[model samples]
Target: MSSSRAAVAGWALAACVYLLAQLHRTSLGVAGLLAEQRFGIDAGQLSLFVFLQIGVYAAMQIPTGVLVDRYGPRRVLVAAATIMGGAQLVFALVPLYPVALLARAALGFGDALTFVSVLRFAATHFSPRRYPVLVALTGMTGTVGNVAATLPLALLLRHVGWAPSFLGAGALSLVAGGAVALLLPDSTPPPRAVRTAAELRSGVLSIRGRVRRAWALPGTRLGFWTHFTSMSTGTALAVLWGTPYLVTAVGFSTAGAGAVLMVGVIAAAVVSPVLGWLIGERPSVRVPIGFGLSIVVVLGLVLLVTAFGDTPPAGPVVVFFVLAALGGPVSMAAFALARDYNHARSLGTASGVVNVGGFVATVLIALGIGWVLDLQGGTTARSLRWALLVAVAVQGFGVVRMIVWWLRVRATALHRQQRGEPVPVSVVRRRFDLRVTGPTGESGPGD
Candidate 1:
């Protein structure tokens, strides 16, 4: 198989595995009503349950980066997938609220490993020019997964019950784990045969040193902040909590809310790649700035309705979903910016930092929104409106972040060129010599 084909297959497998891993997190939104009735828990307690997952996942990201760097993605990912599956099984079988929360926390920690590992794999196997496209495509897979988690899971819950839905998700995760373990090739080589004992120690040290150096690069910081605060917060809130807010506050049914959330994701998945393509085709200030402006507009709409408008009105709900669709491309631009900034270094560090930032933002935002809900006397409509307002404000911060990044990129390019350094081209293609894998873990033939 060609390198391109192998990279494609490997990424497709990774995306599928990630989607399966994510089901536990997103499934809760649709299950909110059911869980409330069964457990007799109020909204605040239920929000805390989700918060437990986010907090665990956020805390685990930095270590996950180190694990990817030292242990290689193949081993780390297989372990994560297995743990994710086990947690889902526990979630399915457990009865008590505390036990379920424990299971959810376990699922959070397990699923935290997927994003960084997949990023490392993509950075190792694919060309630099192709990285953003692959990232966008992988992101789309996540949106698709969110859609499935909502509508399909809701439909499944309608007939089969939540326990069976979770059990089935666990089974799917196990199958995905096996496929990843078999199909994804390890990107690094084993220790050299002729090295002295001293040399062996130095080899391990050198690997750690490279990872450190990569983390310290200026580009890494620039990319990390851009994605973490602005891009990621929007995506997380929309996918994970969107349905619950819609149903609880807006009076939509479980299935109706699921369908609405699905539409939002489908719109985002469709729009993200187009923005990627536009950036690839033009590679200009206009594309990114316009992208940023578009998010501001969409988020502004969201903020307007949430802050000042009536929620039960059909006009506001219809407008909110349409605006929600516009957020996907903005996120795509942020991921692309990360790739563009990192240049020749380890994209894994950049990706990991961004992931860490985004999740941290999620924790802060989710908790803050919870507080706001309390302040609003705990009306579902008012609470949701407050959350939307918070999201819009956060997105405005993203717009500012992007503008700074653009200015920095421009200044750096000009400075380098004036100093007789090579002018960095918009599109760079770097070929790495790593054997790729398929869905079953067999190496691609002589790539």
Candidate 2:
């Protein structure tokens, strides 16, 4: 096949995998209540299940980065998807709660591979300028997947029973896995020689050393940090807990909450690509990102207001909250930024590093917030209220972080220019490299 055709196929497969991964993530939102009733569990148990799922998922990011870099995304991704699908199958069949929780953990571990693979693929195949757009488009597809998880998934789970739903979703995951294995092309140049484990470790460490050089620059480091902090909080709230908040605190039913949350995700889907476009065209991510973060801050305040029963009358308040829900572009912007800023030497590693902040946030802050709610008498109303306040405070910290970073970057650039020092510049460029090797110890022109 031609290189262009191969790249297209790879991207298509990645999209499918991403869609399924997203479905797996959001599926739990609807299943939470059912799982609770079926197992006679409470909020703490549910939180623990989610905590375990995300914690394992988050911890696997770096390992996935390493594996993808070594073996290429094709094999690694297929293995993960298959594992995830099998786990889902077990979840569908298992009767015991403990077994189901273990299944969820396995599913999450497998699902974590999806995004890292997508990041690796984008860095290898797509042009740098186009990477942001592609990443945003990928996120938008995930939002579509989120939408599927909401109304369609809820309806399916209710009508077909959760077991059948899991089986069907598992089938979809396996198909996605097979498709990816068949489609994705390995781009990294084959090893010059079969190196020892120590050699591999040395090489990886060398890459990290170079990565630290890039991170030493204030603009790049600050950008990465701000992106991580914001998305960490946003994803924890929006992806994991938004439905519950709507269902319990806002007085929406499960199905209703699902539908409403889908709309919010749709809003995010529409805005993300636009933000990426703006960043590419305008040459400043801060404007769009800053605007989005402002929305999050506003949403936080609104939640705080609502908690105090000082919200505006019903009609406008719902609209306001829905608009607040639209603040997800900030989260999307963070993903785009991660794709945008990193040097190309070890793209997967850089992305993994950038993503770590958010993973920590989700694990620590998201889980901690749940624990806090449990302490606040373990009721949804009280927990949500407290969680909102915490989200507000956390988001406020993110905003301040971004603002400070922006100012520092600007001040440094001005200082450099005034001193007649060569200022670092930002521009997106294309890169293509071969992956396979020939018999005579030479690289094949793969791309």
Candidate 3:
């Protein structure tokens, strides 16, 4: 078989695991009420229960990145599939709420393993130029799984009853794991060389040292804040509270809420590639001072109104959904920023650090909403407005921190530019056009 074909086949299978991971990650959002009924829990307890999955996933990322680096992506992908499959089965069959929470935590652990593995797989197998596009597609695939967990999972639960629906989903994931174990090809190996003592020492650096070094970079911190601010609300909505809020607050039926969420996911998927292109190719289009903050602020204001105000008209609710969808893809910009500022050697650590912010923010947002709902006496329309306002307030704080870091990074970049060292093109946005020119004087790909 051609090497190219093997790469594609392997990615396709690993991507299935990622899809399952995302499906399970957001499964509680659709199943929140059902789980609540089955487990005999209040809205606040249910929120805490569901958000545990994401919390575990967020906390495990750096460790999981280490696993992928040491053990390789294929093995990690298989293990992730196996763990998630078992967790889902436990979630399906167990009548006890405590066991289900443990299952969700396991599912989150598995979910943490899958994304880093998929990224390592792509980085190993694909050419550099195609890597960014493939990464965008990977995110889009996860979005597809996220969309499925909404209406499709809801309909499945509706028709088949909760146990059969989740049981079947679990069974499918187990099968995917087996197929990956048996059929997936190993990543193409790079040429080996004798390692120097310094290289070996670097690889064994303590986790604290790795994180501290990465955190010291102003751009890395900017990336963290960007990820934190941009993705938390959208993710909280999709992964835990979005559907319930829509149904309880906006008078949408189960299917209607799912449909709206599904549309937003699809819209976000479509917009992702365009954003990826703008960042990778036409970066000069960015306004140096604020970068992507304008759209983020607009999305925040929309959420503020949607969450804090009295049951808004349907128009604003729909607008918030559309706008929040954009936030997911927008968070991808944070990774781009990490790539821009960090050395290639420290990129993985920086990326993992950046990755933590969004999910950490997500867990906090869900908790905030859940606690507020309890305070307001349940999940009524009036209660959700207050609940979501608490969540959005958390997001606003993240945005403020992002701006603070952005100013510092900008100042640092200017210092580097003044010293005549190479800096990321984004640092010079609107100050000067720095694209390379071809023979005919046309701008290069950096244009």
Top lDDT model: 3
How would you encode candidate 1's per-residue C-alpha lDDT over 327-410 as one tens digit per residue?
A: 544544454554555533445555666576556656665666666666777637756666656665655565566556444554
Q: lDDT of each structure?
A: 0.64, 0.65, 0.74
Q: What's the TM-score of each model vs. the native?
A: 0.82, 0.83, 0.87
- In model 3, the runs with Cα more than 4 Å from the true position are 1-3, 187-205, 284-309, 343-346, 424-426, 429-447
Identify the leading candidate in terms of TM-score. 3
**Candidate 2 accuracy as TM-score:** 0.83
lDDT string, candidate 2, 1-447, tens digits: 223877867776787788788788768766777777777776667777677777788777666766676667777789888988998899888878899889888987898788778867876787766766777777777777777887788888878897899899999889888877776777666546646999878877876675575455444445455655556554665456666666776677778867776776788788878866775565455434554655555565555557555222334434544555444445444444444445555556556555555565556656666777777776466567666666565666666676665555555544444445553343222242112122211110100
Report per-prediction Cα RMSD to one decimal: 8.5, 8.2, 5.9
Best-first order by TM-score:
3, 2, 1
Off by over 4 Å in 2: 1-5, 190-197, 200-220, 286-288, 291-295, 298-329, 339-341, 415-447
